[model samples]
Target: MSPKQRILELREQIRYHNYRYYVLDDPEISDAEFDRLMQELKALEAEHPELITPDSPTQTVGSSILEPPFTPVPHPTRMYSLGNAFSQQDIAEFEASIARFLGREGPFAYVLEYKIDGLSVNLVYEEGVLVRGLTRGDGVVGEDVTPNLLAIPDFPRRLPEAWDLEVRGEVYLPLQTFLELNARLEEEGEVPFKNPRNAAAGSLRQKDPKISARRGLRGLFYGVGRPETLGVRTQQALLERLAELGFAVEPHHRLVSGVEGVEAGYRAMLEQRRALPFEADGITVKLNELSLWDELGYTAKTPRFAIAYKFPAEERPTRVRQVVFQVGRTGRVTPVAELEPILLEGSTVSRVTLHNESYVQELGLRVGDTVLVHKAGGVIPEVLRVLTEAPRGQTPVVWPSRCPECASELVLSGKIHLCPNPLCPAKAFEAIRHYASRRAMDIQGLGEKLIEQLLASGKVRDAADLYQLKKEDLVPLERMGEKSAQNLLNQIEASKNRGLERLLFALGIPQVGESTARALARRFGHLDRILEASVEELDAVPDIAEATASAIHQALSRPEMRRFIERLRAAGMRFEAREKQKSQALEGLTFVLTGELSLPREEVARWLEAHGARVASSVSRKTHYVVAGAGAGSKLAKAQELGIPVLDEQGLRALLREKVGQEP
Candidate 1:
């Protein structure tokens, strides 16, 4: 076979194996055989980059874009949240309410499934091929998290039959994966996520797909947005259809009639919750019939046909030994109650954040007070209430007036106390760590120990000082070898090209996250311009608000921050936007691609985005251009009907040559 033909065959084989191993939990080939096939495909793709497809396995490693905004994609049908039922009375009332709405009485068919505490996402498939996976933002519109969703091993990139549909599911990290992730976070001196739900939500929304992939995220489809289109009449049938289409459907969803059966299912789920490999805080009870769903209708927020029956809250008494102050990377001081060790949800809890002085004062807490503690949502351990009414001569929880590490005077910023000292050892270390983080500069060898050593030895005081460190400075540190020191230095030097968005985020600007940084970088196209931008100008950028703009303006205006920027500038780091700098070439234009292309559609997308053009997924009247290729389908016909301009591969390339050229 020719190289192209062989490459196609290898891709098919690898995809089939991926299905077997990840989705089916069975493997036809050994790991070595799989590795060999993957290696061969990678080698071929490396040699012939133009042959790479968007759905290719290699693409799952992640896109190289630093902090690109997830394109907002509207859901075909609204993905509504479920109403909560805390007690048996509430469940009965919900049943009665549904019955009353139907203008009938007695039993109603229902399906009960474990309510997996995780992020809800909608997956859109066109002709059996996965196209978009989105977060349920505002029920109407959602951030397109296709790349991160694709990173999930069990998420089917393609279905069994050639069908177009949308399915909703919970994307969660398994209990084991959550524990491991939390352990890693603790080891890195970073705060652990409160629960698996938070971890899963955080991981799914990660800017980098590779990082999401490493988190071992999993999914379980529960229902379809449009069941009639899929010829499914009941929730149970929808689950079966999802399974038939090679989706990882939620297991053990039982069909029952009336509130009693639903209650039984909920109880069973509660009993089995701890033994399960994932967190289940409740059982979601839904009316099974698709026909009656419309009649049941919905509240403004939640669906009327379904109710989440939550398990009873778990709380136990524990005494506060003392209230201690902890300093975070942001220099915000938090009061934590060092409790007498007590067990809660399979973990020992000795410390819980008091949140602020107001929280402590509200609780009327003292050192000797007994308080109810539990894992809030079976994830974060938190103090519930004080049992004792009287103090009994116990000391009141004291608030500190100065920083615990550097003894710098604390200032109240809004509701919280903050240390303004940039050179404070704790804050400096955190700043350097954040700068070298995988999401930032990604200096691989500068782990926490090396950073602490660099700080303690006075080799580095801030992020800019990191670039100034020589091999001699690192070599003297414990466990630093000649080769290791050189590698570390090389990594640090290589970080200079990480681009302006990453740099902005690394600078630790208050209220500016990775997405906000990207917005600023894309707007101003340079770090210097952003620093000088007026609040009104900053607020003019899409998604940037007045408050965020004010924060950005105020932060850059600080003398310490100004000095830091100068140091960074003197270090020869990139101060200009290096990626996706907007050009007027395709200004006010929007393009949509369809069918087989000579180059990957992603490659075309990158080019369009770089030239100030939007690349939409579906064809609409707003779409100015439709890049049609061989075997173009519905999108092509729609574009033609709407009188949108159509361009072939040759035409697109010629246009590129005339416009943006080979800039990227």
Candidate 2:
């Protein structure tokens, strides 16, 4: 077949696969086979640039080596975040607030929805055809990601007949899909994504439609962007219409006629969050009457009509089976606790991070000791306390004095011990593994198991060695088919072209997370520049501590490290400075999120941060705004007592609007 025809066929096949896998949750072909088809399509498109359509699967990684920073567009309606309620009293106060707002209301009805912990996106459907897709940029304006939106399976390319309207919903990666995607990225010698939310957001924002398409993005329509066009008189009616139109409406959404029912609904959803496939940070409650919604109107940034009830974090108990120490890329040792399997939240818990030796000692944790496990923000699992009555004879696991991989004598730094050996095998392997992870190079088909296999087989010695891999070297490995091997090789090749920030983060520098990496990339702009910085120079950057500076300085000082960086640069790695984007309105402001919001808290935090605000985990005197949603508890009262400005959804919207110079 001609290359043009082949490309078309390949595109069709991959699109079909995306629908089957992402939308239908079924697949006919093996993952390896699927990867091969995508690789073929990408190659064909590369050879014939004119054939590279917006819908092609190869466009997801982004197009153009470097594009201008994303421009934000104003949303048609101000996207309001939710206020949170934590305790029963908080719920009662929310009800009272509703009654006061409506006037002469003993009870008010509310609609409850699981606050999905994913990126918030707005979908504009013009006459039943999906026309525009945008991120909830600054609530008012968002980044245009229309092509990427089309790739999401659940985001209907064409709305159902008789349903031509704009709507808002979350674009999230399901837990299973997220895990699989990360797994694939790991197998190809790439960094694994940090979390599902980050993965989903990063995937959706890809400049390349093809890359977005390949990641299997999905959307769930939750709110009417333009309710008047829908001919719906109430929020309930709008949801019903959304359900009729085959959108993935929240199945548990129920309209409670009074405040009592609203509170109950919020409680029910909070309890069910752990059971849901998608992560829900809180529950959303909207006033039922669509007219009331209009009357309540919106502040510059959010609607006054709805509030989100956040679930209080619950702590559960588990036993520590053993303590395992992991050497990170920069050689800092993190102590991890292997817990006796106990069901917590939604999944079975088997492990928790002790953070460091100091943390372990602070908790008085030892192997065979029962400890309380609680998720902070329903995401990170942490050990709360060790039960003293459990027993005392067990020997405490010794903090490793030497590198587990190369037996290099460990060094003491502030708050952490480190493996000073630049050539520690374990450190090298982990560094290489992290460098190749999804958030880094996003090499498909790479995973921990495969990394281990590669290491054991002596096929890959370091991160730089990944780019040098050949299909022949992989095909001979156990369980690796010819197609799988080639797919991995292709992914590795593609990773060589990833941006500087990703490469920096992938390098697994001590205390350098994705955010830090981005910051560094923005500051230094290149690997060579960062390598040349001294400890003091590194510490001069905001948020970079002395220990982090020392670690970075040490890492850069290594001959092998310098060689690896040079090799990567020689192989076409690119680096560029990121622009420092900041918002002054939220400067010095601390927001205490109580319940749920229309958008995820992270998205809201990002919005606030961009505008110069900080999101604190708990209520404190320093907090400036306490956002109280449906089921807010102690925080709300605390805020009131502290004389901090308390904002319901509408109030918060007003604040944002005022800041942005928009009328509330």
My TM-score estimates for the predictions, one after another, are 0.56, 0.47
Q: Which ten residues in a row have the lowest lDDT in candidate 2?
A: 60-69
RMSD to the true structure for each prediction, in A, is 18.3, 22.7
User: Mind giving the per-residue lDDT tens digits that candidate 1 earns over 1-664?
Assistant: 8889989999889878755543232344433346568778978989998898876765542112223255667888887767567788989999999878889996999999988877778999898899889877646777788878989987888877787888899899898888788645532323456567678878887765767988999999888787887888888888898898778877878999898998888877777777777777788998889888878787655688998887777677878888889887667778899988997777889999876676778778888888878775566677767887534327877788989978877755445566656666668877788788898789998999988898889888888898888888989899999999999999988888889988988777766766677767766888888878899988876556787787678777777778888888888888777665467577667889888997888877867766767677667678888999899986798788889999988888888788877433
Clash count, predicted structure 2: 54
lDDT tens digits, residues 535-621, model 2?
A: 887886545678777867876676656777777777666655433324356556778877877777777766665555666655657
Question: How high is the lDDT of residue 229 in model 1?
Answer: 72
Please report the candidate that would top lDDT against the real structure: 1
For all candidates in order, the CA lDDT equals 0.77, 0.70
How big is the positional error of residue 583 in model 2, measured in Å on the Cα after superposition? Answer: 48
Query: Which candidate achieves the best TM-score against the true structure?
Result: 1
Q: Give the Cα-based TM-score of candidate 1 against the true structure.
A: 0.56
- lDDT accuracy of residue 311 in candidate 1: 77
